[model samples]
Target chain A: MRHTINLFLMLAAFWLLNSGHYSVLMLSLGLGSIVLILFIAHRMDVVDHESQPVHLSTKLPSYFFWLLKELILANISVVKHIWLGNSSISPTLTTVKASQKTDVGKVIYANSITLTPGTIAVDLVGDKIMVHALLEENIQALETGEMNRRVCQVEN
Target chain B: MDVAIEIMSAICLLIGSFLCVSGGVGVLRFPDFYTRMHAVGVTDTLGAGMILIGLMLQSQDILVIAKLVMILLMTLFINPTASHALAKAAIHNGLKPVLDNKERNNTESESSSR
Candidate 1:
């Protein structure tokens, strides 16, 4: 029920933000389309916890900020290595254990690793993710499990 | 205040472009597929993010800024997922990552310890 409301509000806001038109005709058309989409989505049965993720609404913003910070730092590290030439880069592949309990949380953790510049989550098998790191430090960073912990927090 | 904002926007755009260029260079110089993905990730995330944020600052219109924010959100969400999928496919295709021995040993030891 909460998921349905959240999905509706999100779709409405998305429509309004994208459609600059405020005319009665345009507004009604937009609302009608939204209703149609909602009905289709309801039929599809995807408006659940994973699809809507209403529970993470309050926690996501802070996690985003934290991710932004990590992204910037990772970019800086990569930019430095790029300028320093290939001799500076030491590519490493390792498996990191994901602590998240749910699939959404695991996806979040894996995506976060890939989102940061230096590491890519190559494969996810069970709770373990195979990561390709551009530098040895990146592997160490993942080993610290700070990102994993934060993602788990976001899920719970 | 307008001038200040303009300067900040320009700086961000400049940095963003520099990152993109470096990413190109990294792709060319890096030896393997996985390393190249890292380079692309830099450009896809921070490079695009900075450029979009810079444009948002210049736009000043609420709707335009909202649209830019939406684009940023989409990029942040989609880019990583695409990268992950690509990497997964590459792995499934038997693409081997270049690994440093020290790091490999370290991770092996750490995993065993756990």
Candidate 2:
């Protein structure tokens, strides 16, 4: 009941914020069905803590900040590669050991590496990841483990 | 204030487009596949991200915001995966690394001394 109510409240708030284009009848019917589906999903445990544990809502702002910083850095690196590197780019394929314990943490780390410029994580095997890097420098950057450390902090 | 916001958003969009265009150009003009990947990977993510943020700022409605957020979410997840796959495929196809001068010199010296 509690989770259902929470879900309902969340959907309602979101609906209200988006009520600009909807007619009154459409609003009620659309929102009513949405709430009903949400309620049912909650009851079935489909949207349980593990699946959508955004319960740590308070930490979200900080996470956003960290993600933003990384994104900005990635953008700059891409720009530099376009402008500076004429025809000289070194490709490196190497495996880095994964340090995180949880599946979610590992996924996050993998995605983060892929998100950055000049580096791609090809395959994530048990405790080791094969990464393709545009430059050896990018590989060295990943070795620093700052991105992985930040993601682990978030997952925790 | 509205005008200022619009102007900034437009600027962002233009810059983002420029980056995307430059990246494509780099891919074409770059010497090899590895260098091209570097150019493409950087520009695509940053350019698309900036464009999305610019679009988000141009809207005030909630659904639009949600969709924009979703776009960012998708971008965050998919872009890196594609890059990774490309790199992996390149390696699997036996794409060799272009050795730099230092490595070449080291190899030469070792072979000569032997």
List DockQ, one per candidate, in order.
0.46, 0.37
Residues A59-142, model 2: lDDT tens digits = 556866776787777667666666765434556778897788777678777877777666777778897988777667878888
Docking class of 2: acceptable
lDDT of 1 by residue, B1-114 (tens): 999999999999999999999999989877668888988998999999899999988996899999999999999999999999899998899877766655446545655798
Model 1: runs farther than 4 Å from truth? B101-114
> What TM-score do all the candidates reach, one by one?
0.93, 0.73
- Name the DockQ score for candidate 2: 0.37
Error of 2 at A131 (Å): 1.3
Question: Fraction of reference contacts reproduced per prediction?
Answer: 0.83, 0.59
Deviation in Å, model 2, residue A16 alpha carbon: 7.1
Residue B30, model 2, lDDT? 57
lDDT per residue for candidate 2 within B9-110, as digits (tens), equals 999899889888878887876555665676776666777878898999899976888877777777866777787778678868987654454444544565
lDDT of each: 0.89, 0.72
Q: What's the CA error at residue B84 for candidate 1, in Å?
A: 0.5
Candidate 2, which segments miss by more than 4 Å at Cα? A1-25, A28-50, A55-60, B30-38, B60-66, B85-114
